[model samples]
Target chain A: MSAVERIPILKIGDVLLASIQVDLQDRDVLALQEDLAEKITATGAHGVVLDISAVDIVDSFIGRMFATIAATSRLFDAHTVVVGMRPAVAITLVELGLTLGEVRTALDLEKGLAILAELGERAPR
Target chain B: MTAAREDIPIAADEDVVRVRQIVRSFAQRAKLSLVDQTKLVTATSELARNTLTYGGGGAAVVELLGEGRRQGVRASFQDSGPGIPDTALALTDGWTSGRGMGLGLSGARRLVDEFDLDTEVGRGTTVTVVKWSR
Candidate 1:
């Protein structure tokens, strides 16, 4: 097994942004989920923006990771919006029968942050 | 007809990523479109993980092929681990013997142009899939 890699999580206001710029291994996926959960708890962020523009492909494992991350974030009242999914990746996921349940998605980083911002406004202060 | 071939060992999580990279490159070399390449790589990723986890580690053989005017990428995953006892149930969607979403075989078949499964109760299993350029 190779060393687990961490996806850098950046904070913009109360929203945490995790941009996945590398091809993810299974271990890396698990590490990201753990890291995101911890960050949400520590920072008390209201929203998360997962930017996957650089992700070239996704299987069932990675697809489920999105749902898992969103589900985890909800526990801390954080909304996750996955962004920048490539068209090819989107088509493949649909054909593979993965709906990415419970994971909200957007077209790009700008739109994703917008959604998060809107959700943040709607949340109870 | 095979134009080029590479064998990748699926022993760990990293190997699964390697398998995806190899398949992606081979798909490109075969002149597959971006969507086709993505589909093949994604399907291979699922199969590679199954080889490492359920199959208890294995090897993947990827091939670039040309038949007349058709160019295609083919990959075969083979493992010496205990073979699946119930292939039918194994292929059923949402049915998992482990932690997977049970889309490895069935889902892979959906993404490719061709898929074949050869398995025995205790003799190990081999899954071969192909994606042809359009």
Candidate 2:
């Protein structure tokens, strides 16, 4: 088996940006959740943006990972917005009945950043 | 009729990724639309993970089908683990016996053109799915 890959999380202002650039394995998704949680705590960031344009496929596990990440981040006072979901992926997720459950989504990175910024402004200090 | 066939072992998480890749290739070869390819690959990913996690590791067989005007891709996941005792419950959405959201089986059924599940308690399980180009 190949080594589990980690998705890099970059901090821009108060929001953390994680662009998924590889075909993620199940272990990788789990690891990313763990890492993102740690990073959220360490950085004390208020928002998270996940870029999934490169992700061409998503099953229930991957779909759940998005919702799980959002739910987990909320506990740490961080909001997560998924961005750049391919049109085909969106359709497939719908057909699979995985709605991603209340996770905010945007069309791209810039738009995702905009949503995070808006959310950040509304968050109580 | 199947023009080509390949078998892959589903022992770990990485194997699930491999299954997606193989299924995508077969889907592409069958000339499935991009959306169809994505759906089929996604379904394969769910089934492959089920084979590894619930089925205690098994094998996945991918086939490229060509029949008259219908070109398609088919994948069958088979395992010898403790078979699902209640297939009806297992097929219900959000009824997971594990960490998953329970969408694997039910959701996969919606993504493909055909879905078949065969299981027996203490025996084994096999799930076959196919998606034809439209």
Candidate 3:
């Protein structure tokens, strides 16, 4: 039986960080999308930060998957932020008309964390 | 040998890189703006990958239309795999027969100026896309 590869999980203060590895092969994309959503739900953190710095391209499918994860994370009462999108990938996403307006994005992990902190403070009691 | 241009078959996933290279070459030859080039290339990649995955391999034929006037590029992707049953549902954003979000065909259509699809059950499917110079 083939062993399942575990996605890397990192704890950054109160935030649960999950980094997506760079391969981005066609077959792995769907699974990666589902896994990211599950991780966010299970962690029950204040916010979920996804680092896709390793990914060089954001194909249509993957781009949609990111939107799905963001929507799903919100259902679990967690905010989702995607960081480290490559310039080419960003351009491709825009060209493909995938306006990830719902998914908060930042230039780097630090910016993502800062946004998360701001969102955290603004949450309703 | 000088052969008719229409007689040539589109090239499929000979290699993953082939799709991108062809896109870049065609974009330059067509004199498409950078934004339009990226849009067309991304759409081309999605369609090419579909040909490889569901079609069990196929070819994409690209041609630059209108020499001096009305210039544009037309790309046709033909595959010998089972054709889609419901064209309308297939065009829906979230519909997919496989793991994909079903965005390939729909998104490809959205990226270009003109899109056409023809298919027959058990026969095959052919998608043609055109991007005009703006």
Report the number of the highest-DockQ candidate: 2
Encode model 3's per-residue lDDT on A1-125: one tens digit a residue.
Answer: 22344567787776878787744444455566677666666666778788999865566766776787778778877788999987767776765557774899999999999999999899953
TM-score of chain B of each: 0.95, 0.96, 0.85
Q: Which stretches of candidate 2 lie over 4 Å from their true place?
A: B1-3
Candidate 1 error regions (>4 Å): B1-3
Where does model 3 exceed 4 Å of error? Answer: A1-23, A31-46, A50-57, A71-78, A84-102, A107-110, A122-125, B1-18, B63-66, B69-72, B92-95
> What fraction of the true interface does each of the listed models get right, in terms of native contacts kept?
0.92, 0.98, 0.31
List, residue by residue over A1-125, the lDDT tens digit for candidate 1.
55778999999889999999888988899999999999999999999999989999988988888999999999899999999999999999889999888788999988988888888788777
Candidate 1: docking tier = high
Selected candidate, larger lDDT, 1 vs 3: 1
lDDT of each: 0.90, 0.92, 0.73
Tell me the DockQ of each model, to 2 decimals: 0.86, 0.90, 0.22
- Give the candidate order by descending TM-score: 2, 1, 3
Candidate 1: lDDT over CA atoms? Answer: 0.90
Better of 1 and 3 by DockQ: 1
Task: Score chain A of each prediction against the true chain A by TM-score and list the results.
Answer: 0.96, 0.97, 0.83
lDDT tens digits by residue: candidate 2, A1-125: 68889899999888988999999988899999999999999999999999999999988888889999999999999899999999999999889888888799999999998988888789776
The prediction achieving the highest lDDT against the true structure is: 2
Pairs of colliding residues, candidate 2: none
